[model samples]
Target: MKILVPVKRVVDYNVKIRVKADGSGVETANVKMSMNPFDEIAVEEAVRLKEAGKATEIIAVSVGPAQAQETLRTALAMGADRAILVQTDAETQPLAVAKVLKALVEKEGPTLVVLGKQAIDDDCNQTGQMLAALLGWGQGTFASKIVAGEGSIAVTREIDGGLETVDLKLPAIVTADLRLNEPRYASLPNIMKAKKKPLETVTPDSLGVDVASRLTTLKVVEPAKRKAGVKVADVAALVDKLKSEARVI
Candidate 1:
């Protein structure tokens, strides 16, 4: 069985984000970049599956600029057998990404596809579901635990009220959640080895996927600054302020 895992490169979670001077988008120039935290979890899960003899080959894939190859290398260092980089300089939307992954799925014929629940940069939380829909396959999103069986996979998911268990047939899509196993750091030796791992680069057009953006960004602005709280003289003053100044009453 082959497992396909998609990873993404995003600004470091620890870095403080800044809005562009022009209302365009967030600043990303020369900023610290790393694999999406959730994607790291997905990679770790694929690695675990391979270690358990459930998966024969693990392929790490990334869709972004040329730099995204770095993210795929990180996955290889984590234990993926090989990697693929979908080279595109455009800002890819969820639908476009899903289409690209669908194309790869058709070509690779992996029995399982794993992905992060969401990318921190967009926080859209839509790609996995979209991919599953596009492929007409079973989907297990926000999976906390996964077990491979004879011909199906059982997934324990994190839901609103509590955990929910669902069994999906082979060739399904699973999205990793925070409760999934913690990712292991790539060792120095593995990092060196990853450099030699097979990494193929392909354009989205070559895959016959149109990546045109359907949505337009009107403006990107920083959130309004919160106002400081004022101390009230007494209960009566607080009530008066609430009724008059704040208009809560």
Candidate 2:
């Protein structure tokens, strides 16, 4: 069986984001970039499947600008056999991304597709579900555990109050959650070996997929600042302040 993993390049999680002076968007110029954290887990899961002899081949794919190849390289170092990059400069939304992945899925015909449940930058948590809908396949989202078999896969998912397990037939979509597995770092030798791995680039148009942005960002602004708390001398003073200034009596 073949396992496909999609990764993304995003702003490093540790960097402090600042709103642009014009309020157009976050300032990304010259910012540190890294592979999306959730995607790393997805890649690790696929690698483990390959190691366990459940998957015959592991392919990594990324949809973004040319620089996204770096993210694919990271996945390759982690143990992907090859990579495909759907290169585009246009700002892509979740739906468009899902369509792109669907196109790739049709072309690749992988038995399983694993991806991050949500991209940290957008936090939309929609792509995996959308892909499953487009493909008319089974979906298991926010997966914390995955056990693959010859004809099906069982997934343990994290829910609001507890956990739930679902068994899906082959050719399914699984999205990784935080507790899935800890990703291993790519050693220096593996990084060097990844450079020799096969990486093919293609445009979205080449795949017959239209990636036009359906949503518009009118403006981006900073959230309101939190006010400092006031200290009162006594309970009576606190009550008086709440009744007078706060009017919460």
Segments in model 2 whose C-alpha atoms lie over 4 Å from true places:
239-249
Q: Model 2: which residue pairs collide?
A: none
Residue-wise C-alpha lDDT for candidate 1, range 169-211, written one tens digit per residue: 9889999999899999999999999999999999999999988
Q: Write the per-residue lDDT of candidate 2 for residues 4-109, one digit (tens) a residue.
A: 8999899998999888999988888899989999999999999999999999999999999999999999999999999999999888788999999999999999
Off by over 4 Å in 1: 234-249
lDDT of 2: 0.94
lDDT of each: 0.96, 0.94
lDDT over C-alpha atoms for residue 55 of model 2? 94
Best TM-score among the predictions, by candidate number:
2
Most lDDT-accurate candidate: 1
Ten contiguous residues with the weakest lDDT in model 1: 209-218
TM-score of 2: 0.95
For candidate 1, the TM-score is 0.95
Residue-level error in angstroms, candidate 1, position 83: 0.4
* Residue pairs of candidate 1 with colliding backbone atoms: none
